[model samples]
Target: MLWFLFCLALLLGGYYIYGSFVEKVFGIKKQRQTPAYEKEDGVDYVAMSTPKVYLVQLLNIAGVGPIFGPIMGALYGPAAMLWIVFGCIFAGGVHDYFSGMLSVRNGGASVPSITGKYLGNNAKHFMNIFALVLLLLVGVVFVSAPAGMITNLVNEQTDMNVSLMSMVAIIFAYYVVATIVPVDKIIGRFYPFFGALLIFMSVGLITAVVVSSEHTLLGDYELSQMFVNMNPNDLPLWPALFITIACGAISGFHATQSPLMARCIENEENGRFVFYGAMIGEGAIALIWCALALSFFGSVEALSDVVATGGPGAVVYEASFGLLGVFGGILAFLGVVILPITSGDTAFRSSRLILAEYFNMNQKTMRNRLLMALPLFVLGGILTQVDFGIIWRYFGFANQTTAVMMLWTATAYLARHNKFHWIATVPAMFMTAVVITFILNNSSLGFGLAMQTSTIIGILATVVITVYVLTKSKRDLFVNEDGNAIDDDGIEVVAQDS
Candidate 1:
């Protein structure tokens, strides 16, 4: 009961903090009267209303990571939920909200462009290359795990050939929505509704799990039992915890979504409501999953059996439904499917934006960019053939590393602008340190050495660029010609401009 109450308090506190921060930073009166650039046709930008902006933002940020992260976190017992919820608000939510705000202020630039502004040309090029590589790994591997699970769901539920059915379903659903739904209309109608549904479902699911379970006490299970059963020596709780939190806490995927959503934000005040609000919603989802895991499986052995028989999604579905039978199962399936849609759309939009910017193509010609992104999707579909868990693990590590790089660059930029207060800097620094520690603690000799090499290069690039930017701050700090202060290389800085 106390645990539940604590979680509720955290949720309410997070809402307050996120909402207050958004209003304080990007309130409506600060929004620019008009965007600096001419409105592009065909793209969602000019047509987006406030409601549409809200929905698209919600959809773009929701992904499979949140679903699985909390489940994995439960390996450390219910105590892990505390960290996942709080860490998300303080570390993940802030990182995402600020990233969007920074991009909007800069004219809707991506993270790479932001890095370039604070770090320099060389750093920008390196980080962009790194981000692209990481995103490709993320898209293919990250998308595949859920694809496989959805395939399994189709095979079990409807007997429509597995892979083919999953592919057709995904393509058809996204295609119909993308083609018919005006981008702005989609955001307006879908965002708030989707967000509300997400919250309700999460609360309902958590409440159901907690209330129905016989065990009310928090840590009665043995720690040793957590690692008892395994194929190879069971993986430690720390590795799983780090990977799980990485997925939930700070993902590189958020960087991609931040810029894509920036173009349509109704006003600066909306940044807090949209970006940070969505993250809190995601964290709530994570908490529900964690709670479900605890209620359904009392020990690690039980969790392993569930995963072996049905896979992680099944474990999650069963956990969510408990004894409600068919209705519960259907609801579980629908929620899982809906969760990934937001992430997928954001990925598609981000890729298009990157391609458009790279070629200096007009945003009105985004159909051409969409055509370009198809091959990448095909490549991702092909890669789905590999083991889902292995691919997911690799993506999780890569995603955290990419996020750290982004935060490092963002911290430098904020410092230059006199916006790098303790609130932002402390969490950013802690996340950076945590990623480094996780890497060092988990890797074997060869893999660890490679990670160390990458870390060194990234650190050196960031440091050199930061020193250079600080030295040149007098020239570029408040200037508009370079697009340095507002939009980092043309990405929108949501809060700054609003």
Candidate 2:
């Protein structure tokens, strides 16, 4: 309890303190017109109220990460607290804030487009495919989850009454409409209500954990620098814990979602509140779920037993049943159901924007929007039939792999502006090593190599990438004071503008 409280305080304090400092480093100016106000395209670039933008951003990034990721991460013991607090403050919050701000500066462009501007054309193509895969994973993974949750709650296996097929159809339908409609129409209108439900459910869980008769801190589960490994799988702690909890800790997916809200923001001042603040809010939600999973099961062994028999989804159903009873169980189910649905819609919306941007097509008309959206949904729906476990395993590593690019992209932007870049560079380097090591680790889902061998190669790759980035940052189209990249020609400055 004490450790959890400390981590909770750390997340909130980081927002008020470190988040503000990061905001200053970015040097926001109110006089600089945002893409929304400057362009005012009614489809994607329309200005929205600050609260709505925050809610939409929260729903887009939150999804199942803070909930499922934390529950799985908690198995590694209370050390999960260490990653969530530190990673959110340093990595996730920083990635989100910069990604959003950069998009705002670039006329609310997609992440791949921004990567092209800062990192170069090749990186642009790589991130285009990278961002697409991650978004589809988010969209597809989210679809089945809510369908399963609804199925379990209804306890119906038939076609008409309530079924997975029916649920998928309903969800995909909503995704299509949400993708095609204006920013303020479907997503902007409904997300506030979803955000309210998210808060209410989160507060209820916090209350249950704080004042519950059954839950108290056990020493074996308490987090420490020398914490004992309690994970049933006996997985190595170094990279597994980090990968398992990417959403709670530092996710690449947030970078993709930042552009969605970037199109909606009316001022540079709100990037800190909308992007960084939303991530902190997600960290808090993750802490609550992790604590709930730990306490409700009473012991590590008991929790492990349940996980072995019934997956993470079962943990949600059982934990809510244990703590909140039948009524609370249903309410918790509603939260579980609503979360992914909120994210799935925006995932499709982002896919549409990315495709339209790639092909140089306009999104103002319904035809172009549907042209980009239909093929993506069909592919996503077909993928729902693939082995979910395989998809999830791939998704985890791919998710963080994208983070490597996002951090480096942010690092390049910082360097381009003559600002200190290590804040993002260091984390970028750390995540690069993490993904490499994770892939090389002697796990079946990854390349089957010895841990020491993997670590050596991973370190070598990290060094190479770090040096390459440092070299590129010096000359990667350094921007002028007006925030546009300059042409690379001799001594005279070539002033290119945004």
Candidate 3:
């Protein structure tokens, strides 16, 4: 319980202290016109209240990753809490803040567009495909995941046998509308209600854990137990734990979502509250879920058994019901359901924006919007036929790889400006090693190299990338003071704000 409280305090302190410092490093322009006002197109660029933007951003990024990922991460013992707290504070917050602020600086552009400006055309091309694919995967996975849960919940409650494909169709329909419509329609109107449910569910579960006489919070475990590996399969902790707990710690997915809110933020000063603060908020959710998983099961071994048998979804349903009772549990389950649905809708919406930007298509009309969105829904529908587990397996690595790209992109921006580049450079290098080692060590993904071999190779690869970036930082003079990128012939890639 003490450790849990300490970790919670760390998350809160991270927002007030480190979050402010990061805001300064980015050099927020208080009087500067944001894209929300500068590019106000009523559809995507309409300025919104800070509170609404914050809730929209929070719902957009706070998918099942925080809950399910941490539930799975809890199998590794209390060490998961450490990652959720510290990784979120340092890595996720910085990554998200830069992703949003850079987009705001660049006319509400997508991460691929922003990456292209800073990281060169090749990196831009890679991230264009990378971010698009990640968004699609998020869309498809969220669709099937919620559909399945809703199916089970409905059948269990009212005897209506809900087919998974039927639910998928319904969700995809909602995604289509959410993707094509204006930001203020379904998403903005509905998110406050969903965000309220999310808060209530999180608070209620934590309260239940703390006050329950039947179960001791944190499972009566010593702080030293956190360092011990308790995985039933004996998977190595370094890369696995990091990947398993992506959103809670750090997610490249959040970068994709940031631009969505960047277009709606009315002021640069609100960047910290909307971006970094949202990540910290997610970290809290992950901590609560991790703590609940640890305490409710009474031991790591028991939690592992339930997870192995039914996966993390089982843990969510069982724990919510066990702690909150049937009535509150139903509401809690709805909150879990809402998490992915909200993210899914925005995932498709983000995909549409990225596609429009990639093709240079105007989105002012419903026709152009549908043209961009229809193809993605078609692709999403096709992907729904594939195995959910397979897509998720690839998403974990892709998510982190994308995160590494965002960090490096931010590193380049900072280094060129001659600010403290190490803030992003260090995390970028660390995640670079993590993704490299994870793929190489996992038999299904890479060459199935030994952990030592993978780690050494990962280190060497990170070193090469680091040297190249550092050298480029010294040589690159393409960016002007206004944050526009110049080509070799000195042509500006991104236009300066008028």
Candidate 4:
């Protein structure tokens, strides 16, 4: 309990301290008009209040990643908690803030466009394909999971027989409407309600565990031994824990989600609260689930057994009902059902925007929106039929790979402007090694090399990339007569306007 409370406090404190420091480093200009106003198209760039934007962004990036990821990570014991706190504070918060704020500074441009602006056109093109494929996977995966859960929730709650396909069709239809509609209509209006429900569920479960006489919190886990390997399978903590707890820590998916809020943010200053604060909020959710998992079951061994027999879904359902009773059932519905549905809708919406931005299509018209959206839905619908378990396995890698790209882009931006670049540079190098080591060491992904060999190569790759990026950032930066910095490709580093 002491360690849990301390970790939770660190998450909140990091928001006010590290979040603010990153905000200052990014240099938000209060007088400057944001892209929300400058690129007001009503479909995507319409200005919104800070609170509303924060909720939408929270729901956008946080599908079930925080909850499910942490539940799985809890199998490794309290070491997961340490990652959630520090990773969210230093890596996730900064990654989210820059991804969103840079878009606002660039007229609500998509991640690929921003990457292209900093990393070069080739990167921009690669990210376009990479982000789209990832979103499609997210869209497909979210649909299947939620539809199945909703079907089960409905079947058990009432006598009504809800078929999985019917639920899938309904969710697919919602995604289409949510994807094409204006920003404030569907996503902006309902996300706050969904976000509230998610928070309520987390809070309710935490309170139940604290008051429960039958069980204690995080039984027998020591801070001194927190970093020790506790994985029942004896998997190394390095790449596995980092990949398992992506959203709770740092996610490339957040970068893709950030541009959505960046287009709606009313001011540059709000980026801290909306982007960084939202990630911290997610970390808190992860912490609560981790503690509950560790304590709710008799011990870490019990939790591992539950995972082996029933998976994360079983753990979530059993824990919810066990602690909160009937109310837990409803909360489970919200956690498994509503959470992913919200993210699925936005994944498609983001795909539409990315397509529009890439092709230079005018989305002000319904025709253009439909043209860009229809194909993604068609592809997503078809993907729902195939076995994507193999493809989904790669998402963790792809997700972190995108994070590496965004972090490097951010590092370049900071270096070009002469602000503190090490903040991003350090994490960029760290995650780059994580991704490299993960693929190399994992049997399904790479050569199935030993961890020792993989770690050495990963570290060497990180060094090479860092040196090249730093040297290129120096060579690419040139000041014109107007004193505005420009890159080697002749793109303006900072817009004089918004």
C-alpha lDDT score of every prediction, in listed order = 0.62, 0.84, 0.90, 0.86
Candidate 1 stretches with Cα past 4 Å from truth are 18-31, 34-42, 47-52, 141-143, 158-182, 185-193, 213-240, 308-310, 444-498
Q: How accurate is candidate 2 locally (lDDT)?
A: 0.84
Error of 4 at 466 (Å): 0.9
lDDT of 3: 0.90
lDDT per residue for candidate 3 within 187-208, as digits (tens), equals 8888977887898899999999
Residue-wise C-alpha lDDT for candidate 2, range 93-145, written one tens digit per residue: 99999989989888899999999888889999999999999999989988888
TM-score of each: 0.81, 0.94, 0.96, 0.95
Tens-digit lDDT track of model 4 for 1-498: 888888998999999998888887778878889888988888888888999899889899888788778988988888889999999999999899899989888888899999998878988999999999888988997898788777877788789998989999999999999999998999989898888888888888888888988877865666776777688887788888898888889999888999999989988878899999999998998899888888888667899999888667778888888888876767755665688899999999999999999899999999999999999999999989976466557777888899999999999888877668888999999999999999999998788999999999999999999998877776777778997776433655566311
* Top of the candidates by lDDT: 3
Residue-level lDDT of model 1, residues 1-498, one tens digit each, is: 456567757876886965576446433344463231334344545535555565566666767777777766665666667667777777777778777877777777888887777767877787677676666666654455556666766677786776643564575356334523345555445656666666666676666655565543244445453333222225554434655666465676787777766766656666776677767767767777766766667665676677667766777667655634567766666666666655665565566567666667765554665665665566566666666666776677777766766666655665555453344555655555555545655554114444456456545554554455446543455645645454334444444433
Error of 3 at 207 (Å): 0.4
lDDT of 1: 0.62
The per-residue C-alpha lDDT of model 2 at residue 199 equals 84
Show model 2 residue runs off by greater than 4 Å.
Answer: 156-161, 217-226, 477-498
Clashing pairs in 4: none
Q: Which parts of model 4 have CA positions greater than 4 angstroms off?
A: 481-498
